[model samples]
Structures are given as structure tokens and as C-alpha cells.
Target: MTKPANTQLTDARRGDARADRTTFLWTAAFIFAGMTVTILSAATELQRANSAFPVGKVVLYEITGFLSFLAMFPLIAWLVTRSTPGQHSWRQVIPVHLAASLGVVILHVSLFVLLRKALVPVFFGEPYFFTDNLARDFIYEYRKSVLAYGIVLFAITFGRELEQKRRELAAAREDAKKSHRLTLKCGGRSIFVDASDVIWAKSASNYVEVKTPGAEHLARATLASIERQLGDAGANAVRVHRSWIVNADYISRIEPTGEGDLKIEMKDGATVPGSRRYRGNLNLS
Candidate 1:
């Protein structure tokens, strides 16, 4: 079943927080693995060129990739928080994400280029040259930047969705624990009932009359209040009038009143007056 709107918001918030934590933990790993691979490649190329101390070149590339990724990760995380992977809304999410993608690419490329120009010579013992072509460097780096951003998107969205699923599973388990029984405190006493056995309830001035096929129990609460409590417990009972409620499971007949109201007949020959205002809530057969 679909979650309630407020519940969905609460879950989404919890998921977002979880994603943030996941992102932080994973980002460190991401930077480390990324640094290792890129540095290894740089070492291999410099060694092939017979350059001494290829370690400096390796350090330069490692720092560049790491810094660029760091700059863009938060933006990607924010984007994924609002709209996870495969989930979009009517709020122009696509356009906003597109803009974010461009921003990530641009930030990564710009920062990398600036750091390369400044630090390559002092550290790597070589001049930083993009084959003497700025445009070519930008284009080449843009390709990798886009790829990196895509990976970040996948990571952040996947993490949030996984966390969301885990929370929902946990909630389901908790609900299961409480499924068979519910306790109501009223009249200075505690009354326990089998959730499934509850057939209907009605307003009784300052108290509520809860009925099962076997017996009736009175609780010191308003009908409106109990209806909300029952609804929260996933009860099938619904308010049929200002003063009455009926259980969907016990409904056997719906007799339409000429005044556009309804007379809900129960399986036990009991009836409740259903107002026209509440008729829309009924799923009469």
C-alpha cells in the first residue's frame, strides 16, 4: 500500500539523512580509490617516458582528480536528495538537475585546470601543457567530468533509495509486532482488543462504544478521536456519520436513502446511518 503523505515526507527526510551519512563514508573511499588508479596510470606513463621521479607527476594528477571530485560531490548529493534516481516530480526537477550537472562539470574542470597550471611545475618538475590548447583540454576533461558526475548521481541516489527501503522494512516489522493486539487506556483502566476483531464503533457522548460480533466495550474517548486512532492502526472502520462508524469487513448491505444518504446494514442485522457527506468514502458492493 502507498504510504500516507506525511509519512512519506518523514521517510524521505530520514532517507535523506541516511544518504548524507552514506555519501560521507563513501566519498572518502571514492577519493582514495580514484587517487590510487589515476596515480598508478600517471606513474606508468611517466616511467614509459623514462622520466625520473614519476612520483611527483602521480601526486599532481591524484590531487587534481580528488579536489575536482570533492568540489562537485555536495552538489550531486543535494540533487539526489530532492529527487532520487528514477523518481521525478512536476517541479521541473529535470531542468534543475540538468543545470546541476553542468555546474558539476564546469566546477570540476575549472578547478582541475587551475590546480594543474599552478602546481604541476613546482611539484612534478614539468610544465603543465594541455597540448598548448585550452579548448582541447576543456573538451577532453569535460568528458571525464560528465562521467564522474554520472557516477556520483548513481551513488547518491542508490544510497538514499536503499536506506529508504531499509527503514520501510524495519517499520513493517515493527508494525507486525503490534498487529495482533492494541491497547486502549480509558476510564482509568487499560482494555486490550484483537485488532482484527474490532467490527465497528459509535460515538457515545463523552465515551466511545467499540463493538465486535461477540461484545461491546466502552472507552473514554470521542468517536472522532478513536476513529483517528483506529485509522492509525490500519483499522477498516470509518465514520459513516457525525455520530456513527461502520466496519468495512462487517458491511453486508448499503441501502440508499432517498435524501441521498445511506443505511449501512451489517452482517449481524445491525444498521448505521451513513450521511451523504460520508457516502463518497464508501466502497459499497
Candidate 2:
């Protein structure tokens, strides 16, 4: 049975919400793991160099830096989504991402500096100063920030593409399962119609008239809904008029009406009018 259009839309929204939640959780886990590794590595380097800085201070510094990037992560993701990677040329995408990367670097530096100034004094009883020279600090941070931005953009683009492919595969499997038959409730009786056996269908008031080689069935459904069912069933059906949908396999010949319309002749010896507006839908060749 075909679901109502509104119901299908609701289901799609629910699926999207669930996918979003899954992506968020996975991203958070990876970020946390990376932060832990980075902090430990930085602490080890300080120990190897015999630096005067405490391990706790090094960890705090790394945490603040990671937190700054974490704060800016959503904006990077939003920019990537807005860019619609594969849809636009590199010429268009490159400039937007470059400008966004600059913005991210500036924001990240400012955020982490502020965090360290606020938290360091409380923990160690001493003030924190990022640098005396702002220009040098920005240039130093810019390189790392750009690299981080690129990594994140690539990850998001790859994830979205993978999700799209997964959805397409699932849809193909579902269509395969329902491709052979259509269930219709007519006159308080349930009727099963083979998709291949359908010749044509027409909208009658609020209902649709489904025609098969063996029988005609009137079902309480809209022509648009019937068209969707036919498509999902993999039937070679095309809507040639506002009120008519004909199976291309049953169409023997198409005659020009000379009024910018067509007379469609079916193999079953039935005729249906085809609107000129829908002529592009037919494979005339």
C-alpha cells in the first residue's frame, strides 16, 4: 500500500532528524578522542624539553584551544552545507571557503585567548598573556587554523555523500520489494493488480480508474498518488495529461492531433488524449 504524501513527508523528516543525531554523536566522539591525544602529546613534548611549564597547565592550554575550535565547528559545518560542494564549481566554492577559513581563524584565536585569560588565573594564581605581538600570533595561528578547517570540510562533505548513497541504496531495495504488485481497495473488496498488467489509468472526480488487461478497477485515490505508486512499482507509466496516466509498454503509436496535442493509441485498442505540455515526457524516438 502507498502511504499518504503528508505521511511520507513526516517519515522523511524523522529520518533526517535521526541521521543528524547520529552524525553529531560520531563527530563529538572523534573530536574528543583527537583532543585527548593532542593534549597528551603536547604534555610529553614539554617533559622531553624539560620545560618549566606544569603538565596541568599544558593540558589546560590544549583544552582551551580545542574548545575554541569546537565552538567554531558548527559554523564550519553550516558553511559546508550552504556551499553544497558537488553542486558548485571550484571557482565558486574556493573563495567562500577561503573567506570562511579566515573568519574561523580569527574567532578561534580570540576565543581561546579569552578562555585562557579567564581560566588560567583561577587555576594557577597568575595572569595569562597570549603574546605581546598580535601580528605574529595571527600568522602562527592562521596556518594551523586553515589546515583544521580543510580537514573538517572534507570530513563533512564525505559524510554527506556517503549518507546520500546509503539512502539511494535503501530506496532501491524498497522499490524492488514492491515492484511486482499494487494493492487497491475498491468497493469494499481488496484487489491485487500486477504492475505489468496495467494498461492505463484516469482520474475520475475524487477517485482514479485503473485499467488492466483483465479488468477495470475504481479506487478511492488521486491520480497523482496512483502515478507515484506506479513509479515506485517500476511500471513504465507516464502521465500524459492532467487526468490520464498511460503505461508506455502498452502504447502502440502516437498520432499528432495537429492542435498541439496527441492521440495515443494503445496496443489494447484504447485511445487516450495526451496534452501538448506533456509531449516532452514521451519518448518519440
What is the per-residue lDDT of model 1 for residues 1-285, given as tens digits with 9 covering 90 to 100? 568999989877877777777876787687788788878887888879998866866687778878777877777887876665577773766677777877777787778778898888787677877457877877787787777777777877778767865664455334434664445545767676766677778888888888877888888766765665566567787788989887788888899887889988888778889999888788864
Best by lDDT: 2
What is the model-wide C-alpha lDDT for candidate 2? 0.81
Q: Pick the candidate with the highest TM-score.
A: 2
Which lDDT tens digits does candidate 2 get at residues 171-263?
543654566666665886757787788899999998789999989999876787677767778889899999999999999999999977999
Off by over 4 Å in 1: 1-11, 89-98, 117-131, 181-285
**TM-scores of the models, in the order given:** 0.53, 0.56
Angstrom error at residue 105, model 1: 1.2
